[model samples]
Target: MVHDILITKENPFENDVLNFRDHIHQFCSQFIFRKIPLSAVVGITGEWGTGKSTYLKMLQMHAEGKNKDVIYFNAWKYEFYEDPLIAIYFEMESKFKEVLTLKKYKKVLNDFKLYGTQFIKSVLINSISYVSEGIINLQDTKDNVKKIKEKQATLLEKRIEDLKGAKELVDRFSDSIATLAKIINENTDSPLIIIIDELDRCLPPHALKLLERIKHILSVPGVVFIIAYDKNQLSHSLKTLYGNDFNIEGYLIRIIDHEVAIPSLFSAEYFNKCADKVVLSNNIYIDKFDESYKGLNPFAVTNILMKLSLRDQQYIMHNIYSLNNKNKNITKISYLLVYFYFLGGLKLKNPSVFKLFESGTITKAEFYRKVLPALNPLERDEVIIGGAEILMAIVLTIISLIEGEQNPNNLTSLNLNGVNLEFNVHLVADVKTRMTTQRITNLKNIPKLYSEYPTFSLD
Candidate 1:
């Protein structure tokens, strides 16, 4: 079950979807072995759910095998903290001791450990933030005014003291990073590579602050930071912090030396890997699928799958398996219908339309209107109209029986636009819809839903 589990220990599927792994590995290897000035931040950016974390895990494995110091830090895990910078330092301190020899780097380890507790306290309790700069006017009694003025005077004095100590705190933090980098350079033969993941999942403030802190304080020459995130998302987050006019690319250029977008997973080989798993697991045959129908054609379907994330592809495969297991006779056609539902951006978005089809309330016109635009961009001559008509009618009959229509038993054939065909709708069992599709269109593009999501159907 590749659902919700992180691909940590195992390497990626190199002979399959992970063909991109070799290229990414070669890039990281070049950066490490070439010894072209370490301690720069490299970004592993991609859209959400595009196997960024999985790629990092593979990269971590590659680096570890080369004896490079590797730390896999998850930024989202510590987003609860007020200052993620403290959490960042703590994660590094915790991992360094585990990987490095204690006696060999005892003094440096101790220095790194010393700042963790004090920094936590300073961020949690003694931190001062800008409240307001405008003058205040109040209507109050003289005694109240006097007491407020005295309190302000005391607070102002304490703030001045805090401001005086702020420089010392920053110096201590910088010294620790520099000291750790130097000691690691001395003790270890390989560069220290820290892979920070899920930076995009952090809160807007935490994400921005973490990058700023890394740029200003923790930047050391021998330490290489590989951060995995969606750069577009991070840029949006930066805008949330510094207004719409924020120079996000400029800010990122200062922090990150190399920005690499995770390559797109768009290959027919990968699609076949997923499709083969789904079809064969249920003992279904590929030839039964209408190869002449462009949408169900394996190569044509691969084009649509290419646009989806790996997780989404899994979700679709799982759904197909679920649907296949419940029906026996028309297994091949059902696969096309399920895939088409997903390809056309149904199943998850527009439940009203989905429920119409599911509940057998979808009229012929409604089904045709909803499904036509989702078909492959081919002229009528390119598609086998006979296969398409028969397939659509078979799917409609299945929907009718699933919705528990009366006398739907012994349904052997279907008629579509005067084209008659044989089908086995009775083979479909009385199974209810199992999974609930959430409204995640805000987080993702729901296939063709945006431009093609429909309105109330008269039929």
Candidate 2:
């Protein structure tokens, strides 16, 4: 499993949705992160499965590590209301009320009686969230299975009954939830770090409204709304919503003009670090990831690979020819070359795609063709130069999964048949709903093939 970070042969670091912090390290280190009282909104751009959420988390942790006040929220989730700005108002109200002492905390609560219903809700729901999400591995037990099952059955029945009453109580009190979040932030040592992911996944019209709302309101002090986005797709979504004339990047520029693009949150260097941490140093080699290929970006590499295997991607042109000589209006293969590097030794295990959840509006295929394209534009001209190179790096990252290179950072696995990670192929939408998807590119391969995508181990 790609879950463990230490004492595992397969790297867990790459899987750290929060590992992409290099982009903000400088700004954070120099200007606000360690030095000043700065309230800045750092945004990220990536398609749905490109792992923006994980990387944003890494950045937040990195900031918090440096002792900065960080607050984060996903606008797509927070801006579910009609005003959307209420999401903003809720944020402000929560922070202010939290500064009060126990006495103040109570007085603040009394003054916030209107939100009593919400406070109960926030606490009740979060009390459940207070549990660690790490899956517990049970040791083998040969005891009485039937009796254990009966006991668990009784416990669940009692718990469900208790929960039912609590939920009803909370449903009537939503405002207090906001107040609770504020109090929670106040007691924490670091800044309030709120990560709002899947911005580009919402309805086009609704998403645009939320974006505008964030621009106007989410900039409150002590809260650094770490927004995760895929700019290439987001702009397109905006076009669909506002108009063909709407310029999404331009609109984003007017407000969130500065964005921290994590070029290689999944870079070879980072993954290499992960491998060393998890596995015995003797089992891995230093030069396995081909250090010189650093300049190539990750996305560009994956893009070219996807295109090449697409039916061998032949090109044909028809033309009127001269006497007897066949005339083909074939232009130069420059565009193809422009897009590809030598298709070197490489193999990938696209993670098995599965329907995690579904709402009536969002389907599995629709998630990719519609949602994914915007969140992670697999094929597109990028604003940042060297996109092709960036993709080359990505190709190697794929190979890392296949051959188990740098398995320390983020362990990727594959069965003999391969894997395909997808989300909501079945669309069951739940509130606080996350896009149900898979990490699809987990891979595995032998040494000879491993040498193709990533460098071979020295050992």
Candidate 3:
């Protein structure tokens, strides 16, 4: 009855699983497609794997459906290119070619291509020269001094000329974009909308260069930019460029006219659906631990899942699925499902503490202290009221089961805050026997045991 955990790749507009249609409609109608006097850069910011890419896709489809010209550019896909401007220019050129013939817009495109290349090259050469001047030895001599002075004078003159040319080229480039935007707006009655996605995934220099290009050259009338990125990750990239002490918020404010946060996908209903697809689909018994132990609180579990990114949520679920699949008999003991869920949360929320606990380097009491503060008030209350003790008892019971005991005599009499919680020793034993066969002797081996499952990194 187990089902594989497949990452959903269907179009968000088609499926609308995350219920983003309303948000997409509102943003497009209210801000994006609405007529404004000046061009604007709007940022759609969210944490990594919070569905920024999918959201952008939805926005693009909506814009296109409204008869607005939309350009979807993924910066990371072109990170290998030295200059992001080149990639952006090509993307614009390609998209525009569909509406206007290449010959008609060829001159503007060529001018942009030629000047942008020259400007970038000039900057690189000047930077190299400036650096070289600092390291080069310049010894004074009657003949060499005159020569050096002459060379400096010539270089300074050329540098001024280059600067002027670069300025002229930049101005021309801006004018070309303005003209193009005007033409497109006149033809379609809507400003050209460009959706720049995955900018946070690019190298620091590439990402910063693209941002600079947008601010200085591409921010023209009749054009609007919707940039999707992880704000924190992009901030880190900015810090990598400007220094750790740089005012990231101040700088971003100057670049982005407005920012919209992606709506969170966490809710009790969402978690229940994920659970159905991941855990319950396997026919696992998750209703009650025993006559004394009730099922996991849906709200409490939602709170924990909310603490993790979408990628982490899937990761935890998939690992749990792998564990249950490997030891099918463990599914019969409904209470163990609670422990598994807790373990997954522990591993994700505080990996350092989880590692210590897994290696047996920390006791149950120590683990409890470290993880308690991370939980919400409700979860904290649950932990204090028999949750912690019951978890420890279950671990001991599982260990005893692994040791081939008919009954864990020590755990049989275990009491949790004056309440006795019974254990299904046979089911617990089955889990251990499978683990033993897999060479997993202790908690530390669990990660290795489930290492075959895919893992994702937060941006």
- State candidate 3's TM-score: 0.74
lDDT for each candidate structure: 0.59, 0.40, 0.66
For residues 1-459, what per-residue lDDT tens digits would candidate 1 score against the true structure?
Answer: 223323333443344364666666676765654443347888888997677886787777766665667778888888887787777776787777777676867877777677656666766666545233212235546768877677667777777887677657777866776667655655565566778998998889888888887777677777778899897888888899889999888888888989887777555466567667776666765554444333344333434423455655666556555545654433454443443434334554344566554443555457557654444432243234434433444445444433445344444554434444454342322111210121222112222332343332111
lDDT of 2 by residue, 1-459 (tens): 112223111332344433444455664554344322234456776654455655555555565554444445566676556544456546545644544446656755664555543443444454453123212214425575666567567766766886785565444333343344355445553345555677776777767766664555345444455677778778778787677887766777776735776553333333333334422132322222233433233323333433322111111000001100221111121111211222221122121111111111223233234323322323333322233333322332333333333332232221111212221211112101211121322111111221223222211
After aligning candidate 3 to the native by TM-score, how far in Å is the CA of 397 from where it should be? Answer: 8.2
lDDT of 3: 0.66
Clashing pairs in 1: none
Q: How many backbone clashes does candidate 3 have?
A: 0
TM-score of each: 0.69, 0.40, 0.74
Model 3 lDDT per residue over 63-128, tens place: 777677889999999898767877787788777667667587787666656665666676556656
Q: Where does the lowest 10-residue lDDT sum fall in candidate 1?
A: 430-439
